[model samples]
Target: MLRDSVTAASADRAARGRAARKRVPRSAHGTWIPAADRPDPVGLLQAQGRDRLPELLPVRYARMAASPLAFLRGGAAVMAADLAAQPHTGLTVQLCGDAHLLNFGLYAAPERPLLFDLNDFDETFPGPFEWDVKRLAASVAVAARENGHKEEHVFGAARAAAGQYREAVRRLARQGELTVWYQHIDADLLLPLVRSGRRRRRTEATLTRARRRTSLQALGKLTETVGGRRRIIHDPPLLEPAGAMDTASLRKIFSDYRSTLPEERRLLLDRYRFVDAARKVVGVGSVGVRCFIVLLSGRDADDPLFLQIKQAGPSVLEEHLPSGPYVHPGRRVVAGQRLMQAAGDAFLGWTTGPEGRAFYWRQLHDMKASADVAGMSPGELRAYARLCGTALARAHARSGDRVAIAAYLGGADTFERAVGDFALRYTERNADDHAALGAAVVAGVVPAAPGV
Candidate 1:
């Protein structure tokens, strides 16, 4: 019996070693990358992003790639794959998939406080937690470069980001239940926490700007005076003029989606009567896919609500993470989005449309806001990056094995160096992808109007 026990233990150890050995592929630095492969990280994402561009306005595409910085802003999908190939402690979590500098911002929580957490989770999934951190770090380095900061500052910010992630995870690992429950980052409390004078001014300015991004502002800009009435109009080949969706078809899709939601969510949605629905263009990377906004109004005209039904493609992180065969990619996206976001759109749902196209639906504008990284000064960038880092730690802590991660990170600078190295390399790769997209536009492969 003793010999048999010894043999079983030996076999288990051997199996674990073999699996680990198979998992760790070589990195860009020539070391074994235990998470995913090194090269071709951007292949699937680039293909998907390119296909989605025609849905964008001609002017929007030009504007999205107007500058290297702008181009970098639009290419989160491409950057994700590069970061996924690095060495990590194998701690999986529901990642934000595209947690760049621009993805963080203020939103109204159910409590009415200006709460901040990851806002976009379309590409989210259970994967190596470092992929999200690495993406955020690379964006900081690149955005810092765009703002004319020196390399040292960029590297410093990257290291600070990793340090915060490691420290936060370690702290969370040892925290009492109440301590973990009580933590939340309010934008109002941020100015005092940021030490840099330049950064403080930037944060103040950003806060002021975010306050200006109200529902009324969005309505004013997106809607127009049509036939002596204000309405959301579609501009052809650019903004799909509002009549794009057939009313019958929309109801059918929504009905199918309704069947997929939980009983409580389905009942909550009964309050919303879909008024007008139309397909619209949104972000640069997410262009070309079918995205529609459903206008919902209650008894009074003033009681208006909006919901966005977006098609969910295969995860950009799936190539890196373990996603057992999904019957519907939209379900995977909705699940990941729910896992990562502290508070999500109340009406979020998922359905597989015609031809097996996967899609997830949510509130179109539930008080969403984003950082204007283009306008931020260097100091502001650093402070904002730190905030992003801390928030990322919180998100990772929600679904990942924090204890094992903290143990692997154990007072060592591996988290810092590994991500910093990825940031530097991947930033260069971003520039290249941006250039390629620019060339494609120049070759007339894609269309965009001037001042876009």
Candidate 2:
């Protein structure tokens, strides 16, 4: 009787998913006509910068103006508004919110093997699952073009991403809840496909580099033996000493973040003693945000741990979608990351900082691995695109009604093909937006300092 009830519930959810097709047909997903009154993309970016450091706004523009892909990375707010304008599948899940090619990478939880998965979560929030998929597809299309892949390969890569996502979702929907819960993409899983000897060696080297990226490794690169003691190196405008007040504030908030961790982890953290802190600039989209690196010593001066504290603002999707369960943006990011990533950081925590800003903390590096999209060949790009799609599907399945979403996707290539079309169309729009930003920089409408 219990088994029968579970079956009945699944059937009902599947029916609801199918019913959604009538409201927004699969073909409808192919469209991307900007509304006649679409807001100017630059103006939208300017608005996003209002909360950022005014002195650093030019850096954001310069980074964004670097390429169409860079523009897309920093232009999540613009795309969020655009995606909100369209009809959705209404199949909700915790979204990566900015699921671009670069964002899906390899990293490991404390004392675990590396796994390739979604690593960025600053914009994470619950929303229609397709928003994440579409973002990934669009990014693949843009990167392929930037890499000089032909149009045929461009469409092929985009379609591969959508196709793998659909296939993975269908597979996950049939698995037991526990099976889905424990599923993870081993970072080495893609090795079987690298038939070329040289490429295989390069891939292995990349993985080895990722594994070596521990806190100890960070100690060497980010710190120096200053006046017979270790200190965070100062490289003004990028990395600088956090003034005395800021340093004290970070120390004060350490306890609050400690409270959010598991008891055992708290005991582990208590072993470390604060040493120094520094403000650091990071990422294309994340530039100008309040981010700091906290250095701590454990056991002895030789045993060091680095934790990054980044201010969390409302997600770009916040205005368009309903508010997420966590009111504190830092908590929302931490919670969303824990839910999506197969393995999580041992030190992941959140707290409110000076001026009531929400901030989240986690080990630096956290042992990250991201693809060099600029260096990938057409075939390499396609394979990586498919892997990202599968990772995204697994994350969505863990959080959403996988059976229903599988039903919505159906067993046809129709949706994937339509998404390919959407990718190309949106790529055109994205290129134009990128060009406008460049124009703004040239006309002095916006400040820009390239090569920073």
Candidate 3:
């Protein structure tokens, strides 16, 4: 069976290569995934996340099964599986496979500039652009439903997301590379859009809050002194303080990781000297995985930089992607993240943990935050959608075929309509899944988390 799978994958790669060569505008291999024969979205997610589902908060689990639409929206791996089964236009890159309403956010670029890009790369891989769009649109539809919008209103939001994506991609193609790079979604452009009749006062308030979100705030929350000692304290079953790890065991792991780093980075990091590290649970999907936040203090007390070393599992995008020479999943994530984000963390790096687990390291809380969906108005939603769309397009353009994609999209109308259709259909699917989850919770099939 393994041999057969390998052979089939090899054949697919060859076919994709040929197809890419024949196209009017050249593109990466296997970039497009036709919508006709996608996978059963729900089943795909269940399969990929089976081992970790029990570890998720029951409230989150309930929300996943709250409705078919909700389930479909949350089950990105499932969608990727389905998309992988279809024919595609063959534009490929390291995609943020689970791009959704909440995934877009603000971050510090390398030059200390604040920029926006896809914040999550857990599912990053070379995949079809449409798959990302479909997922994002569906998320809008489900999120709208979560906000109490009716079906028609939900579809309207999805349509709006699609329209924005179509227009934004084309617009970037016409701009100079430097101009596109310098461009950012600031508060000024959005205030008028929201203040006008198109948005609500409440939504404007949310954007106002998002604009204020920064890494400094994260540092304040995540960094604290414990028991008269300045340190990041442990929040049990979640954020475990470093003092919890067995020193002998950690020293062994750190020694191994040191070998993996380049000589210069290793030397630079060595100056801080390892105080301690802890196993932490982080993010919705990443909980229960082995995540460690290493605290390294240099000469001064304020010179402390916390680095989160998170385990890298197989890409949620693995099934759809053509295998390459990447030996470490962590490396794949780090590389893809650097390519996709306009500016990345200066300390971005990767290493293996004890037991050979792939892990990516980054400064914890270097001003990371997200948009609050519940606080957004209809107008704010639309403006945020445009921001995410343009960012997604730019990320893809950097790694894939911008010229071909732009030519195929031509103008936003046709593609937008197609995406709108898929989004509406998928949103219905999410509602169904969400409802199923609720049923499961009621039946005690899955325990419910407190928040729901």
Task: Evaluate model 2: give its TM-score.
Answer: 0.98
Question: CA lDDT of 110 in candidate 1?
Answer: 54
RMSD of each candidate relative to the true structure: 5.6, 1.1, 7.9
Per-residue lDDT tens digits of candidate 2, residues 358-419? Answer: 99999887668776678678898899889999999999998999999999999998889888
**Model 1: per-residue lDDT, tens digit, 1-452?**
99899667545543543344235421222232334444442344346655454545455557656765666656655565555545444556777888876778777665656767777777777777767877788788788777777787877777677778878877886665456645667878667655768767776776766665544455555566666544565765545544644445567788888877789878877776766666677775566677776666665545666667788887777776676345577887777766666665567788876556787887665556776666465566666777888888877777775655665565666557656766666667667766766776788765667543
Q: Return the clash pairs for model 2, or none.
A: none
* Per-prediction TM-score: 0.82, 0.98, 0.79
Ranking by lDDT: 2, 1, 3
Lowest-scoring 10 consecutive residues by lDDT in candidate 1?
A: 25-34
Lowest summed lDDT window (length 10), candidate 3: 24-33
Root mean square deviation (Cα) for candidate 1: 5.6
Cand. 1 Cα-lDDT? 0.66
Name the candidate that leads on lDDT.
Answer: 2
User: Each model's C-alpha lDDT?
Assistant: 0.66, 0.91, 0.64
